[model samples]
Structure formats: C-alpha cells, structure tokens
Target: MVRRRHTGRRLRSDESGFTLAELLVAMMIISGVLLGLMAVQTSALVTTAQTRQRAQGTAVANQVMEQMRALPWASLSKGMHASFASAAGGDPNVTSSQLHPVADPSITEPLVTSTDQTTDRAPLSGAGGSNKTVEADPSIPGFTYTSRAYVTRSAQTAANVLTLTVITSWRANQTTTQKHVILRSQAFAPTGGCGDASNQPYLGACQALLSGDAGATGPTVTVAAAGAGPTGPVTTPTTPIIPGTEATVATLSVGTAGVGLTSQQATAVEATATHGGLQTLTADAAVAAVATGGGRLTNSASNDAGSAGAAPANPADVTGVGSASPLTVSGTGMSLQLVPASGTSANLRATTTVSCATGVPAGQACAASDLTGGGASSVVLTTGGTPFTVASVAGGGSAKTLGARFTSAAGTTAVGCAALSGPGCLGTSVKRTVGLTSVGQGPWTGGAAPSGLASVTSYTDATLVERGLSQRTTAGVTTRTGTVSYWNGSGYSTLTIDRLTSTTLVTPAVTTTVGGVTVSASATVTVTPAMSIASHPDPVGCSGQGCSVTSDTGTLTLTVTYVVTSGGIPSAFTAAASVGSGRASAAFKAAPSA
Candidate 1:
C-alpha cells in the first residue's frame, strides 16, 4: 500500500507541475504573433482600400469635372450646383454631401445621389462634410463611401487655373481609411485668354521661371538695360593754294558819264558803302567810274526812210492779127435771085472775103476767089483776098422749100429754108376729131368692109321680130315685137334695141316654151343711179343729223325695167332703180402740199 501511494503522488506531481507564469508567458507570445499578423493584414487591407477608394474617388471627381467643364465656366462662379451619382450605385437616389474636401473650401455644396436616404445625408456637419466614414450603412445594403472635392486658385498667376483635390474615406474592418487624389482644371471667361490685368506680370514671371535651372526656387523678374543720346556738326578745312601758276586779270571801260563800276566787275572790284571810317560813296558814282574804265558806251542818231521802188509797169502795146470777117447773104422765094448771078444757069452761089487792117507779115499774103463747076466746087482762099462759088441747086416740089447749107473753113455751119404755099401749113400740122352715134337694131351681117358704121347695127321689123321671137319660143305661143331707130348721119340708118333688167330685184319663176318643149327661167337685176351732188356741205358736218340735199334737182335715178314675155307677148313688167344722195364726202386733202 505504501508503494501505491508513492506512485500516486508522482502521478499527481506530474499532472500539476506546469506553473501559471509559464502558462501566462506562452499565452503572451501567441497573442503578440496573432496581433502582429492582424496588424499587417489591417495595414495591407487599409492600403488596398485606400488605393481602391482613391481610384474610385479620382474617377468620380474626373467625371464630375468633365460635366462641369462641359457647362459654361460662368455657371461655376455663380454657385451652380450639380448632382453626381456614384457609379457603383445603379440608382441615383442615394447621396453623400462629403463629395468635396476641406483643403479647398471654394466648393461649398456639391451634390450626390444614392439609393439609401441615410447614405445620402451629409457625412460631416455644416455646409459640406468631412470625407470620412465607418461601415457602410446597413440600410443602403451596399458598400458605403465618403468623398470630398475642393478647388483652389493657383497662387502663381491671376489666370483662372484651379487645382482640384478629391478625398475618399470608408471603414474597413472597423478602421477608417482615407485616400487622396488631385487634378488640375480650368474655367475660362468668354475671351480665350485670362482677362486678369495681373496676368501680364505673371506671364513674365512664368517665362523666367521656365528658363530657370532645374529645381530652382524664388521670385523671377527681369530688368532691361539702358541707352545713350546725340551731338553736333563738323567744320570744313580750308583748301591750300598751289604754287607756280600764272594769274591773269582783265579790265573794261565805257565812255558814258554816269556809268560807275558795274556788277560786271564784281570779281575784281571791292566797293563799300563806308570805307575805313568816314566817307560814303553813292552806287551811281562807283558804277560810273567802272563803266568809264570798262569802255562800254552807246550813241544815238536820227534819219529819214522811203518806200521801196514799184515793180515795172506792164507794156501798153502788143502786135497780133484779129479773127476774119464772116460772109453775109440774103434771098427770098424758091429760086435764087441776085444781080451778080444774072448769067449763071444755077443761081445759087457762095462767097468768101479776106481782109487785114494790120499789114500782113513779111513772109505772108492773103488771097481769095470763087469756086466754079467740076471738082473745084469747094473754095480755098489765101490771106488778104476774096473767094466765091456757085453750086448746082434743086427745088422742092409741091410748094415746099428746100434747104441751103453753108460751111466755113473753121467748121461753122448754117442752113436756110424757102417759103411755104398754103396757110397754116408753114412748118407741120396735125388735127383730129371724134364723133359718136347710134345705129338701128339689126342682125349683124359679116362683111369684108366696115359697113360705114362705128359699130354693127341691128334692125327689126314688127312682123319679123314677132316671127323671130316665135321661132325662138315653144309651140302654141303668141309673140309681140318692138322697133327703135337711130340716125347715123346718112339718114335714118338702123336701130339698136337692148333688153334691160334689174339685177337687184327678186324674181319669180316663169314658164316658157321653146322648140315644142317646156323650159323654166328666172332673172335678178339691180340698177345703180349715176347721180351728182351740185352743192353740198361736207359729210362730217351732218354726221349726227343726216345730210341735207343741197341740189335735189340734180339727183336722178337710173330706172331699169324688167319685162317677162311668153310666146313673144308681154306678160309682166317690173322696174328697179338707185340714185346717189346729193351729199359730199368729208374733204380729206387728197394730196398734201409741199
């Protein structure tokens, strides 16, 4: 039993041997390792979340900015607000007021939309909220997010350049994490470049800044250098005279009294109004002296003038011969009668004479004579003589005169005529007369001779006319005939009868017979009067009222009577006529006078 008890004690000691300190130490080590692992995981998760949040926030910010940029820049400064829903949320009902950050407070109240009303509430207090948050609201049932954006003007220049910052915050594993993103943006006035007055200085600064060494820091300003001004003119040096050249001088003089030294001597003379001190000389006196020494003078005189001689006068006399005298002769009756021609068988003769008041020239003489029968009938004469000739003649029969012709050496021609026998038949005469007459009616008989009538005449005996009409008519017809006579100078020659008809009259059908056969015939006739207007006013004067007949007695109608005879017997008769109104037409000048 004692051995059993000891064994028990050993077992109990083995079971209770591990102390509390050792146990506590082992627990501390395990806890530290686990805490370290947790910390590492937390840090990694926070970094990843921050990066993700930052990326998301940056994307959201870029989207919002793109939208705002699309709007006119003027709208931004007017405090216009725009709502941007997170893309992660399908619905635009959920919102976050912390979409803008605190760093640049210019963006006061940016808008946000979300599905959960609680998520859409402001994340912080006041106008805009901070960009931080814990777990996503369970009410939203989606990842919760906080975002903030801010805008700031660049201090470098007055130009409308803005820097935008977006911060996103959210809870991850019960720890808050924040991410930051930045972007640059700009708003422009309507004018393309910035309108700020201070931009000029800023531009200079920017140029200097760009040219500075890498990593340079400080204000940049450039200064310009200065310049200089102007002066006067330079004087001319005197020219030196060369040696060994001859100098020649000339002087002239005039004999006139008041001619002093003239401007002609300006190169040689040196005259002054006051010389040395006291005396003064007149310009005239000086000029006079110069003129006298220069020998320049003038003299005047008077004389008479006469007209130039006239051309020689034309001669008063000339020597030449004049034209010869013409021959003259006269006679009466058909036969030539002359005292010198008593013995001549043919009494007609031609004579020519020549004379010279101025004696003939030494080598020339005049001669003239008459030409007789044979080939010498033509006369040829010499200067200072006379010539004559007798020509054979023939008389004109029947009391008509013959013509005599004479020709001169110079080709002058003349002709003469004898007397005529009958009165009014001296030269030539012609007469004509016309007469008109009617002849008795008769059948035209053709003959070789003209029947001694102007036109053919027709004659009809009462019985023969009736028989002719009956022969021309049909059977069982009775006939009648008429006769008319006209005197044609040689007693009562014959009579011509014509049937007249009124063409204007409307006719009626009449039956007649011819050659034992029945025949039908009709006639229409009209007669227009040849009337005269003795005295009537112009038609225009009576245009409204009908014209008045000035001479009614002169107006006459031509009556045309129509007779219908059957079987050579008169059956019915009608008359139609027309007369012109005694009215004158409006006078239109037939021809205009020049």
Candidate 2:
C-alpha cells in the first residue's frame, strides 16, 4: 500500500513505518499503561510492608504482656518498663535502634528484622543499612519495632485493678508505614481484692488497717529512697506488703466489708507517681476497660516521627540552674539560660512565654522572639510544625491565629554537630539532637548561663521567679508573692516555683468631673495574668510546657472609671469607663542570677 502526504509525496508500504502523529499516540498509550502498573506495584509493596510490620508489632506487644504476667505484681505496678528495639542495619542478628520515621542515610531500608525482638539490638548511633533479605534467615525480616509500656490506675475503675498497656511501634518504611499495636490487660489484687475470705497473711493486716482496728498490728510500710524502691501490697507472706509515702497510695475495699461485712474483707494497697489527689472508684474488682490498640492515628505519610508521636516535653528554658539558681522569666520579655540537653539548644524549636506561666497562649506564642545572647542566639527557623494559634491552641482552630515567627525547615540545624556546634564535649553518648534556630522578629534578647550545667540529671531550687517588675535581674525585682509548685516529670521531688515578674508597671492619677462637681480620683490597676500555671492543668511537668498546654485568654484588660461624688458618697459613672489591654501573661523569674 502507498500513502500520499499533504505535500503530495508518495510513501511505499516498505518505507512507511507510521505517521508522526500515529507514532506519538502509540507511545503515549504504552507510557500510560506502564505508569499505571508502576503505581499499582508501589502501592502493593507499601501495603505489604505495613501489614507485615503491624503483625510483628502485635506479636511483640503480646510478648511484653506475657512478661508482665509472670513478673511479681509489685514490679509490674512500679510502672518502669524498658523500651524495645529493632535490628539496626543489614546484619539481621544484632538489634539496633528502630529508625525514626524520617529518611536516614544510615539505614538501607527501614524494616523489621529478626534481631529486633527485644534481644538482638545495638545502640541508637550504631546502625546503617545493608542489602539483606528476610528469606536468607527466616528469623530475619525487614520490619523493626519499639515496644513501650504504660501502667496506670484505671480511671474510675476498681482500686485493685491496674491497667497495663503494652504498646508496640513498628516502622515499615519512613515514607510509608508505621503503626502501634497495643495490648492491654488488668492485674487484680492477687489476694483476691484483698477481700478474700481466707485468713490470708495480709487479710488480718488489711482488716486491721481498714477497720481502724487500733488493736491490729499493722504491716511495716516504707517509702523507697525518695521512692526508688517500692514493694506493692500483693507480695507473699514472708515479704509482707507495706505502704510508701512518696506517692499517692490507694487501697482496695471488699464489697461486703464496710457496714455489713460478715467477715474480714480483702484489700490491696497500691501507689503510683501522680501528683493529683488519690483516685477512688467503687466499681467491681475486675472492672477495667482496655483499649487494646483500637485507638490509632495513621500519619499522612508526610508527618515525621519527631512530630508524629506526642512531642516530647518542650525544652524551652534556654538556661539551666548549673550551680547557680533555677531559671525564671517575667512575662514574655525575659529569657532563660536553657542549657542544651546535649550541648547547645541551637536549632530546637521553642518559644518564650510571657503570659504563659502555667502554659502557653495561642496566637501569643507565634508572636514570641527567639532565645539569644549569652553563648547562644536565636537562629531563624523556617520549617517545623506550628505550635500555637492566635487563640493560643497548639493544634489551632481559632478565630485569630498567629503565624510562627520562624517557620522555615532550612533554618533547622543539627545539635551537637562538631562542625556546627564547635569543639568541647559535644554529647557523644548522652543525647540526640536536631538543633533549630530562629530570631523571628522577636523583641526578646537571649542570654547565657552564668555557671556550667549539671553533670547529670539533678533537680535544683535554681529556678526562681520574682513577681511583676521590669528588669531581668534582681535589680528591678517586683513584689515577690504566691507559693506555686511544678512537678518536673523526671523523678524529681515537687519543686517550688514562685511567680516573678520582670516587666515594669506604671500607674497614673487623674481627676474627672461627673455632674458639674470637681472630683479627684486615682485609677487602681492590679495586673492579673491572662494565663498562669494555675489556669491550666498539666500532670507531666516540662520545661516549655508545650502542645497539650491549654490556651490563654487574650489580652489583659484594665477597666478605667471615674466615680461621681454625690455629697459625700461616690456614685458610679457607666459611660465614663475606660478600658486598656496588656500582655496576656505575667513575668517569670528564672534563676538567682548567674
């Protein structure tokens, strides 16, 4: 066959392969099919990896539960459990750190391997990836897991029942799949609610204790050294149970023991590390609701591990109490001498709180400046999660919102980097840091710690806050008042925190006439924090008092008014009132001054 072109050129059958338009169309069709296939394959691979990891997580959680069951009830109730690790790199036999859900050049492919099951792990810094397959050693697979446990008293549930939740976190791939498989169980008072009819050794002791039987010889109860060693109530006869004083102690009561107890009732005494009032619920002995991993939040493939999990307590105090006094700030103006947990808190995302004593304010935080001065400075950050809104909500959904001052990823720097942080003992075996910095149009000028930081984790009375005034140092310290305590979660005894202010105040005297009479009046203004530590409740005391912190009421409003004097009595003037606004928080004192 022969085909003639538009220009009248003739093409023979052998010479005619195809027209340009036809060839182009054919290529496009083939490309579309190939792309579709590729997409399907990618999806399948990701799904397969995710499913495999989740299954492994479930198994690990179950294994932890088994360990808890066999452990002495006292040890389980202590609530200190080790975190599980996953195999590090290619060598499937030894376990290292389970990679965080961020791309790491060190890890070949984030997967669960054989050694990841609690025993075969290395440290956080030792793993890099290798080309290995689970098929080679059936025990080795690509999925990795981290197991965490949280044991606490069930809310409004029985006192004898403890909720043990074993959490398993697994990562299939940083970009694809990461999930937590939770397994929960309830451990009852081994002595059968301490209500068992049998004359159990503690039965008599519990009856004597609960019945207020003055004649009863009570069991010896003791608080571990600052509450480090504690033996719960359900131990054997020889190791009779006792009470501890460092924490809240709850006791189990028998249903029939109170007024109508035909016999001595069973009971279990328990203690835990929560500062709130003791919890008492009258539910049945075995009543406990289990989440069993049902509650889940699957990241949108874009959320990084750092942001995916609950943000670890915000490390905002720029200053530490080295050998000096504790850190304090008055309102948003003053900066703390927060020592880098590693070396320098360079690029860590943080905000200075003015009105946020108890917590941070919504749109208020976005307006804060960075920590600068001293040895450190506030470097500008462009990328990170927005912490608070104009309404002061961490996960903001408010009428008013304040954009973060420094919100660029490029601004983020690495902490403890030899090249970035410069020499000295840069936390090699101590901490992990992703340093961040931002100046963000801040009015705050940061400073350095006067003394060196503690060699280890130690709590000090160093953080001190003076009431409202206008100076960072004791020079301008205002009226020191009020007793406040903040529980710093890391095993420290309750530390006393005083509300101090570093902001200056001005009061004015004015005279206004209402109703044709000369009047002399002075406006009294008392500064109340738009938000303070008392305003919000946080069980986990932290440095920054981050996300979960409640929002602050916007603006401190001072009402102004002049009263009308009728003869000798002062009458109110509604229309003559005046209103003014100030910062939403109070000044906080950080230390005794370096």
Candidate 3:
C-alpha cells in the first residue's frame, strides 16, 4: 500500500517519476478503453432500435390475427395482401381465392387493411394505435414493417375449419437478417351457413346457399350444386326443407355428415309425406336423357306351326293362282275361276256379283288376262267349261310376323342435375317412343298340301298367297322396381318408385341408376388458391420477413371444409375437399453442390 507521485519533469530512476514507456502504455490502455466504450454505446443503440422494430412487428401480427378471428369462415380464403381502398372484397387475387360460393364479391371495409398505415395496431384495436411503426423496406438505415395473411386447409385437422395465419415482418437493420412475427387463428363453417355470418364474405356465402333452395314448391329444401367452379353439391340431399310439404326426407347429421359429395353424385331423390299417421314414400331422380323404348316383330299361333289355325285360303282349280302346292287343270283354252265369297252359288255368276281375292267372280266371261299371272304351272277348275277367262295370283315369299317383340332393358340411362342449389343443370327424360326399326319372321308363310296326297301337278293349281305383311310392330316398355335410401346428413329416408302409379312414378330425368344414390365425378365445390398476385411498395407489401426480404409471388394453399354422407342409397358416399398449396417461391438460390 505505497503511493507514488510524478511531476511534469523527467526524473531519475530513484526520484519515483514515471518512465516514457509507462506513460505510453497507460495512454494506449486509456485510448483502447475509450474506443471500446464508444463501440459498446453504438452497438447498444443499434440493438435497441432493432428490438423496437421487432416488437412493433409482433404487435402488428397479433393485431391482424385478432381481427381475422372475428371474421366468418367465408373470409378465410387463400390470399396474401389486399388493400382496403374500395368496397370490393376482392382484388383479382383475392377474388379468385374466395372459398364460399357467392356472386357479389364486395370485400367489407374491415377485412382489408391499409398497407400505408403509420402506426402499429393495439391488440384490442386492430385497425391501428399509437405504437409507432416504420414503413416496410428492405433498403438502407431504417427498418421496414411488412405484413401478410395466408389461409390453408392442409395445416388444419378439423372439418369445416380453416387455418388463417397473419405474418408481420421487418428487417433488424441495414446489415442484419430480417425477422418475422407470425400469429395464427382458425375459422369454421357452421351448420347454419358462413360460420355465424360475422363478415360480408360469411353473410354472402350463407345467403347464397339459402337462395339456391329458393323457388322450390315445397318446404323441404334440397341443397344442390351452386356457384362458379363446381356444381351439384352432393353434400346434402334434396330434402323437403325451406318452406314446403315435399316432406323431410332427411336432415343434417351431427359432428360431420356428407363429407365428399357433389351434384353429379345425386343419383336419386327420396321424399316422404306423412298423412293420418301413415307415411307415403316417393323416390326419383333428375338426370340427362338416355335412349329408351324400341320395337321388334314376332309371330303367334297363326304362323302355321303344327295345326291349321282358324281358316286359310284354300286353292282350287285356277290357271293363274300361284301356290307351292296347287290343283292344276289340263287344256290350253281353259281359264281360271273362283268360288264366291258367300260360296253358295251353284252356277257361274257375273264378274262383279261373285268375289274372290285372287280369282275372277263366276258368270263373267273368263278373259285372257286372268291367266297371265299363272307362271309355268296352271290350275284349272274341274267343273268349269273350256276356253273361259279367269284371274291368276302370283306367289312370293311369305313368313308372317305378329309385330314388335318389344326388346327392352331393365334400367335406363340419364344425366344432369336436379332443381336446387343454383343455375347448375337440367335435363329431359326424352321418352322417345321409337318406331319399329326391323322385322323378324316366324312360321306364318305356308301353303296347304292335300291330306289325300294330291300333288301340285295333279290338283288344279291357282296362284294364291297370304303374303305381303300380316302383322304390325309396336314399341314396348320394360318395368323395374327397387328400394333406395336417402341420407340427408341427419337421418335416413326410404322410398319406393313404381311405374304402376303414374303419379308416383318417377317423372324426373336422370332417375336411372344401378346402385346407390348418384355420385359426383368431382367435388361440388372448390376453393382456388392465391391467384393474380402482384408486388406493392411499402406503403405496399409481400410476405415472410418484411417486403424487402420477402416475396408475395402470390401463391397460397387452400383448405376447404364440407361434409358428405350415405344418402340412403345402395352405396353411401362423401365429398372430400382438395387443397393445392405448399411452400412455393420465385426467389433464386444457388444450386446445392454435392
């Protein structure tokens, strides 16, 4: 504990004065301390500024998330940045990314935010507050605050629920890495519609769905395909809901019901009306038109099978009557004659008095023309005088038919959507009563041979035929019956369709199906991801860490929530939502070297 002092003058070794080297060393240490202190002060100031910006960014993110949570499910669509400049709820990108099926895309004032705002929003007042915030920028001294929102189904595990994530970001400093503050929330599409209708998107979507069931004649409502993108919403059956007596075939179930369904999947409709404690059942469908009935020809007992039916034309002695087996007469001048229609004449009568289909009447002089039809074989009457003129009949192919056999199938074919949802599709049954296209032969074409064994050369032969067309063809119908079930989300309903009861018989098109209720080729609804994206300067925006370090290439993931169930058909089904989004970017990076 010895104290030493030094004067301004240089001193001897024993005088206790400091050396030049010691002074130099002390000066060097002090200079180093001062420089270090200055550096520490500068660093602390920079750190404080960076921390403030980050805090502001986090606050902004929480503010946005709180605001989003208050919105309806309809607003939880895939998108990035949207400006609240107009009533349009949609920028081109926001519009294309809408989830719910709606017509007017008026984005309400609250859903959109101003990218040019100067203040950070308080957690309570999301619009804005006194928290000072910097404009989002990637360049130079000051930090920039940028924000964005993303919606996706892939990130969510619940049905009828969507994930909404708000990301607020800023650069720590000119040389520091960018930072981000992310806040996430969820929105659900409730049973009533648009998840309670808090915002315009939710209200519009819910109203649109209800409007789809408008104009129906009954209280039971059928939820059909609606809006743009997809149709034929098989999510719910066409129930007697809304405001009619069509009957409540079924109702929506709890938890989850129709999961994956669309309009194309609605193969049938079932309705039940209770009267006096008894329920009357009705089941049918409306589909596109398919070809139905046709005709075919067939023969009956008159086709000359085993025994001679009723009466057939009997060939007698006539020179011109052509028959496979006929009675022939000799003498070149002899002509053919015919028996009267009444067949009671004992003597020959005038040509007009007696009637025969193939021969001249009795009494009239036989003319040379009467024999003209007799080919190589000639038939002459054994009782007739020689040189008399008569008529002749030519023979041709003969195989008579009864008419159309009425070839038909059990089920019919059809297409199109039923009445409901929106202006989707409609079809006609097209009960085309097609004509008899072709004819088939049976055993009608035949001729009588004498039981006494008289040959064509021996018996008088005259050409006589019952050929031409003896039967008519007609189109016929084939009937079929079966049972079907309808699951309207809540319960099941059974129905029966019978052709016998024309009134209850299915008159709707697209009714024919082999298995269960109709199934859709694709989902009745679809939510497109972010589209039509663009970059806006601070007072503009992008994504991730501030507009400077992030890019709003305008891409997004979609999460659609819907339900489907077995609508009491042979096979129950569901409707599944499709998501099309992941980590996508237009930013360039160096190729990874192996």
Off by over 4 Å in 1: 1-28, 72-101, 104-155, 159-182, 189-594
Model 3 CA deviation exceeding 4 Å by range: 1-15, 77-143, 192-594
Cα lDDT tens digits for candidate 1, 1-594: 355434433455657866999999999999999999999999998788656655655665565445444322222332212322332222121225432334334444333322222222222111222222323435335655554434334455355554433444444434554334445555434233322334332221111000000000000001011111122111112110001111111111000011001010000100001000001112233322111111111111111112133211111111111111111211110111111101101111111122111221111111111111111001111111211111111111000001111111111111110221111000000011111211111111231112211121121110000001011111111111112222233333332322221123322333333333222222222232222222122232211111221111111111211122223322221111111111111111010000
Give Cα-based local distance difference scores for all models. 0.22, 0.24, 0.25
**Model 3: per-residue Cα lDDT over 233-257, one tens digit each:** 3324443211122322211100000
How high is the lDDT of residue 389 in model 3? Answer: 13
Report the CA-based lDDT of candidate 1 relative to the real structure: 0.22
What TM-score number comes out for model 1?
A: 0.19
Q: Model 2 segments beyond 4 Å from truth?
A: 1-17, 81-143, 174-178, 190-594
TM-score of each: 0.19, 0.22, 0.23
Better of 2 and 3 by TM-score: 3
Query: CA lDDT of 206 in candidate 2?
Result: 26
How many clashing residue pairs are found in candidate 1? 65
